[model samples]
Target: MKPILYVGNINYSSWSLRPYIALRWAGIDFDMVEVNLDQPGYGDYAIAEILAFNPAGKVPALRVGAAVIADSLAISEWASETGSSLYPQDPLARALVRSAVAEMHSGFAAVRRDLSMNIRRRCKAFGLPADTVRDIARLDALFAGHRKHAAEGPFLFGQRTVADAFFTPVATRFRTYGIELSADAQAYCDTLLADAAFLAWEQMVLAQPATGFSRANIDRLYT
Candidate 1:
């Protein structure tokens, strides 16, 4: 049986986008079910539905037969085992990729909090918080270092890997918030935004009906 992936709103669920893009990039075929996270009664209905599969009651849960895989990184690893190009062959390179993916999975709280992923909305003249600025700088440095060692590809560590999938939402965040990036970082974001899979996701996000929920703090930052 083909795997089934449960996702949340494409406009705001960065975690959901991670595995969705990873599976697409890895050429893994799967069925996707979108849960309306912004809808009324989401906590009681959507959360309950997701909790049946994932104890954490989170989006981006993957179900393969009787086994359920929770978390984006876990799903990415599973895809790699199935001949997906989610990691490198060399031990050292694979380790580096894993490290990057792990950092993305756990770090960048300020960026995630301050600039929530809203693909459908673009804020104008939004000044980032000090912590978020620092996070963006770190991301620039990380992308630069990886680009230097990459093997003739636009993606980090050369070609599309799990690391790139993990950071894809960050790229969209940079665009939505009008955050400035260094040449290398901007190019990396450009490459991701230009990807067919990413574009398809964006199109899907745009097609979705608007959710009434809004982030007041983020909106306040706008001019």
Candidate 2:
């Protein structure tokens, strides 16, 4: 049976973007079902509807036959099919990728919360909270540390993996908030932002009606 990926707003959902990118790179064909988180009158009531499929009440849920999988990382794992690491070959590489993906999955709450993800908007970054600054610094350091693992390609693993997919939303957050990065890290972010799948997602976001959610106005609803 064909899988159905229920995604949230591409403009604001970093979690949704993660599994979608993983699915794209894995060349796993699936139908995308968008769950609009808010609407003219519904506000956040629309978000609660995801409980029908995802008990967690979050998006990026996947339906495979009779089984429903929630959690962005879980869905991404299914897409990659090499465990959470998504790199099927070398043990060391797989472990490193897993560590990185796991870090993205559960850590960096500061960057994830403060910067957030607003793919279609750009803003001057300033007044960053101390925790957020530290998060960005750690992210930059991770980018530098992980680059040596990639002996060839621009991606973290020499080829795109679920780790890179996990990082894509952070890259978008960096861009949207104008968060400065080290040159190498910025280049990595640039690569993610220019990825064809991501570009297509951005275009799709452009076509959708404005939800009136931006970092300038809405703080948490878009996330």
Candidate 3:
């Protein structure tokens, strides 16, 4: 049976998008349950619905048979086990990929805080916090290094991997907020934006009405 993936709003759920993209890229068959994150009583309702399958009370949880896998990274790892092209074949390359993904999973608080993911909206550029600037520089460096080393393909590691999936939201954030990037970094972002799966997700996101969940502080960074 296909696994069930629980997701939140496509326009704002960055974590949920990771596994969804990974599974789609891997060509894995799966079902999805989209919880209305913008609805009234969403917190309680989402918690209740997710906890029934995953104790973590989070979206992006994958239910396979009787087992529930929580966390986006964990779900991606599980999906990789199904002969998915989520990881590189070389041990060293795989290690680097995992490192990039883990760093993205735990770090980048400043950028995430200042430039929240909102695919449905685009904003004008404005001065960013020092920390956010630093985060963007770091991301540019990461993308540059990967692009330099990749022998083929426009993706970070020569082919799409979990690392690319993890950073996909970052690309969207840069675009949405008009974050300045080095030419190479901008090229990478452009490639991701042009991806068929990413385009499909964007179409779905645009079709949904705005959830009225706006961050005033982040919004101020845009026009």
Question: lDDT of each model, Cα atoms only?
Answer: 0.83, 0.81, 0.83
Backbone clash count for every predicted candidate, in the order shown: 0, 0, 0
lDDT of 3 at 120: 74
Clashes of 1: 0
Considering only N, C-alpha and C atoms within 3 Å, which residue pairs clash in candidate 3? none
**Candidate 3: worst-modelled 10 consecutive residues by lDDT:** 212-221
> Residue 148 deviation, candidate 1, in Å?
1.2
Model 1 weakest 10-residue run by lDDT? 212-221
Per-residue C-alpha lDDT of model 1 across residues 1-223, encoded as one tens digit per residue: 8999899877888999998988897888899898767544454544666777877777888999998898899998887777567887899999999899989999999998887788877875456688888998999999888887545688998878899999999999889888888898898889888999899999988887866444235444564
Would you estimate the TM-scores of all the predictions?
Answer: 0.91, 0.89, 0.91
Superposed by TM-score, candidate 1 places the C-alpha of residue 27 at a distance from the truth, in angstroms, of: 1.3
176: Cα error in model 1, Å: 0.1
Off by over 4 Å in 1: 39-46, 214-223
**What is the total number of backbone clashes in candidate 3?**
0
* Model 2 stretches astray by more than 4 angstroms: 39-48, 82-85, 214-223
Ranking by lDDT: 1, 3, 2
Residue lDDT tens for model 2, 51-145: 77877677879999899888888888888883334575888878888999999888999887688688877777777789989999999998877
